[model samples]
Target: MTGPLDIHTARRRYITVCVLFWLPLGLSIAPLILLFTERGMALAAIAGFFAAHSLTASALELPTGGLSDVLGRRAVLAAAGLLNLVALTLVGLGSAPWLLGLGMALMGAGRALSSGPAEAWYVDTVQEHSGLDAELRTGLARGSSATSAALATGTLLGGALPWLLGLGPDLGALVSEATSELVLPLSVPILLGAAVEIAFVAYVLTALRERPRPAATLRDVLRGIPATIVGGLRLGGRDALVRRVFLSAGATGSALAAVELLTPGRAAALTGASESGAVLFAALACAGFVCAGIGSHLAPLTARLANSGERAVMVSLGASASGLLLLGATAAFAGVASLVLATIGYGLIYLGLGAAGPSENDLLHRRVSRSGRATALSVQSLAQQLVGALTGLIIGVLPSGPAPWLLGGSMLLAGTFLWIRRSGPASPTEAATPQPHTASSSPSAVGSGPLQQHADQ
Candidate 1:
């Protein structure tokens, strides 16, 4: 058997996987909506595409977690990468809205499949080797930073590529003609994303290996998955901390959905052309990712300053809500100043979220056992996706401009209060070490807790 994994090795692998997983998404983010419009899709049709992706992802989140838990992380991740490859290809090449929707569905499935496995694997490996109290915040922060950095790099390059191609030799036009307009200049980034998915698959296959579990038939997985899903669901109801985390995740999701749904159109209006807007949005996205990277890099320091993860999250939420409020307030103004304010507000929101995520996850890992790690993460992701779906619907009906941002800001402000007080004092073990023993585990970790009882039943 291989030797136990070291923390440094595990952390390095974790950050590497994070970069690989997120880079393709960053590459495609600049052009996805613009591409649909380029192909003659309407506002409602674009909304439907996003809704379809969200619904598919949300529906599969729990099941995919169970699948990862039962089947091991590497397999599920590789499967996701392969699926992403197909999805990106279709999206890059297809013009019909139905075809695009089909591609988006597959992409959502890939997202669901890939969601928790890498981080789960890292947490599991770390806890196994370093014990449950291992200092997770720094490593998690670094991973988050790496992800943001990848996105920033990808966005800048992807955004510039189309503009660059059109300028030099009119290469985009030649390519568009050659492919019968299936691969427009805007489509190049997504097609490039497909190439990166291939790399993701290869990396996962080679870099990740699970400790051997007892050999079991396919029957074992089939039976265990539903049970795991049930256990994951019970966590929110039974544990105060878990419930709060779910609530925080949902609120953040709503805020994000509003920004993403509204901001691109506003940007399109600002630039006065669909094509120019795509480029502008890409640059803005790059800046936002840079801000997020800075926030992630500062998370450990934030936790120290706040004196606890809970306070850190509260502070982060407040910052995000403040930014959203600013965004809402500036919506009516027109000109360079308003655009600059909007961009700053958008960057701040991302920055706060990036800072909050690692601290929040650090607490989550403290609460969960290795066995349920992926499932717990999945539950968190499910809350985000479900709330995001609802937020999209709400935004669809709302009047354009500040209303959606105001509503989202209000929700985020409410979430900030969830962590104002602790459920109880941290036990001696929890207080003393980064890793907590079972007796001193977060409220969610109580063995005889209601969630455990529900699991038994």
Candidate 2:
């Protein structure tokens, strides 16, 4: 009998979905960075924009996530893509700061709309077709890889397009020879990205599919917000293991966001490479993402080798924190080589995190009811956003120069230590156990014991 999830079909679907989803994100990066630069905006202004963007998206995440649970994932995803198309268009055209901010806010709304639903759709669809256990790792890994690939392609295009279009340094030289007017080259990529987003929306509306409706009614949806928040918290609170996972994930996410925000400046300063330096930093970050994708692909193997999900999570977090610390410290005192090395470390950490993420998600999913799963996941999403916002805010308040490195390193170290403390120690014997059995098993299996034991090991 054919399983609901045909691996080949699911892989194609996952890749297609990721491309549709991440292309906008990838296209947005360079253009947005350039947008701020072209507009003569300060880092503070950009940070403010990001903070507001994240806040608005965070506000909308729960409701939108619940909507996906009720209304149908495809509908939500399509809406998200359309929203992105509109947002990117506005961003491309707008010259004024207010207009740009408005566009950014709209983009954030689009992001919120898309975030939880798309992942849920992928997971649910694959599980329905192939079975959860069979499809989870491959599907998630492929999705992550597809997103990274889109990001890499977009970053490269974003950097290369202006130069190719006769709007870059060569254009400046040409203009000096003629009109003596420097054409702002950054806007070109923004316009191009807007075009790409428009195409993505069309693709999503045409290609994306949804599972059967899992929830109905506005009340049901509204009720899900509190239920999800409380239920996820309750579940995490009760389980030491789950709580550790959430905390570690949240902390790592915060540190990463901070690192991302600061690294470009550090790269530019250290390399003396100008605006193009930031683009290089972005490319390096994407490299880390590629590593992460590879790690996610190898997650099953890493988990097997490590012997426990908790240990894998802990190791990944530690590695990521170490990378952040190294990046910050080296960038503070050293040159471009250190920056590159830091990036390499960042890549390794991402790979580890990618490998661990599925295991952590699987652990959480096991603890929550189907009805509440989306909501619980939304809470997790919220934690990530909240942490990101906090990190940005902190970085904004801190002094410049190596301050970012110090702050990032401190947060990472603190977060890592806390995660380690929360995770505790795993015995060597505990890890070598076969699949479908956890360390915390009971001799007398009863009711949910067998399933729980299977999951835990």
Top TM-score prediction, candidate number: 1
Clash count (model 1, backbone only): 2
TM-score computed on alpha carbons, candidate 2: 0.79
List TM-scores for all candidates, in order.
0.89, 0.79
User: Over 4 Å off in model 2, which ranges?
Assistant: 1-5, 37-48, 130-132, 167-185, 202-207, 214-220, 223-226, 335-343, 397-407, 413-457
Write candidate 1's Cα lDDT for 1-457 as tens digits.
2855889988998899888888888888777877888999999999898778878988898888877876778888999999889999989899988999999999999989987888878877887788867888888888888988988887876777787889968999999999889789999999998999999999989887668764546766766677667767876786687788888888888888878777778778888997677667667777777877888889899999999988998898889888988899898889889877887788888889888888888877776655566777788888877787788888889998789889888888888889898765433234222222232112112121211000000
lDDT of 1 at 327: 94
Give the whole-model CA lDDT for all candidates, comma-separated: 0.78, 0.60
Model 1, residue 333: distance off in Å is 3.7
